[model samples]
Target: MIPIADKYSTFARFYDAMSGEYPVYHAGRNIGISLLRQRPGAQVLDVGCGTGLNFSLLQAQVTQGGTIVGIDRSPEMLVQARRRAERNGWTNIILIQADATALSPAEIGSRIAAEGGRARSDAVLATYALSLMADWETAWANMVSLATPEGSLCVVDMQKPVGLATVLTPLAKAACWLGGSDINAHPWTAVKRDCVDVKAASARGGHLQIRAGTRRAGT
Candidate 1:
């Protein structure tokens, strides 16, 4: 099930503390930057982006010339994100209020055209957001719709809970309240399966990315 917007609206303030700066978000950002190749400029989208925490890192990778659009359903979260954008003087970045799953190709097409078209975005990203979605299927489908034929897509989510770490249950439960995280016991695995099953398109050819990882870069 997808999480209600209210669930995250309440936790925008303490999200970073809940995430533990060194581990969760930062780690994901590092990996994303490397995968994106830190191109001097690339149009990018951060689907389900929360509080714009990943912006600075992603911007650094894509550079000042790059464009990033961060979308989320919670205004409270987007408020924080806007604050960050102003703080960074990021004129190229735009924030939108919406669910990731609803990011249809038609919507993406219009928005991209309005924002200066040319299929500017080379990357589509989802970091620490999918696990909290109420309808992961729609969200996954929307992501497929948003990316270009050649666009690179990357996602970083918590690994599913392993067999009863009875001792860690309390800690895991606490993490959930902070940002509705860990709602999916097997988030990564489940999403990976969906990705694999999805018939997606790429610049070179039609393809699918599965949780089982049937195909991937440098493979």
Candidate 2:
């Protein structure tokens, strides 16, 4: 079997085309970003920001005055992200390649500072990304540490379909399997547990779970 990293690297160029963004995943991100409700000039961090799919939506919220720091483990993926940023003439984006679960927050904060962003962002988002990590909780902790005291947090991930959507279970599992994600991971639960005033939404027949909220103090 191809290693996950290699798989991502090899597939980076084709990821957006095969990712089912329009039909399946985009709704979750839309809900998550809408719930985040960031203001103009806000700084945002996107973990596992593959091909910068969230960039356009985030840009709509933060505008040109704001900063966007995108982190992903695959260098090839970062390349695609950078290309997307350049293609749209978005100069406010800072792409970094690193393992989200293992990075040092201080170091990453410093790096962001070097790129003209604040030490901590005003908002943090992860879409269809966390479930790919075996140690997703550690990544979640890092996300918290990289945000401001009351920064907005959003997580969008997948699960088995429910109710009438149960008929799509096999397709959902196939997509998750192709992406090397644990469909049962339920990483958004951490957001619900650790964040306050959490807003929840689901789409695609409950196959997509989205949670957004403010970071609790001292968390």
Local distance difference test, per candidate? 0.62, 0.93
Error of 2 at 54 (Å): 0.3
Model 2 Cα displacement at 111 (Å)? 1.4
Local distance difference test, candidate 1: 0.62
Q: How much is 145 displaced in model 1, in angstroms?
A: 2.2
Error of 1 at 199 (Å): 19
Query: How many clashing pairs in candidate 2?
Result: 0
Clashes of each: 12, 0
Which regions of candidate 1 are displaced past 4 Å? 1-3, 116-120, 160-169, 182-219
Per-residue C-alpha lDDT of model 2 across residues 29-100, encoded as one tens digit per residue: 999999999999999999999899999999999999988999999999999999999999999999888898
Score every model by TM-score: 0.74, 0.98
Residues forming the 10-long window of minimal summed lDDT in candidate 2: 110-119
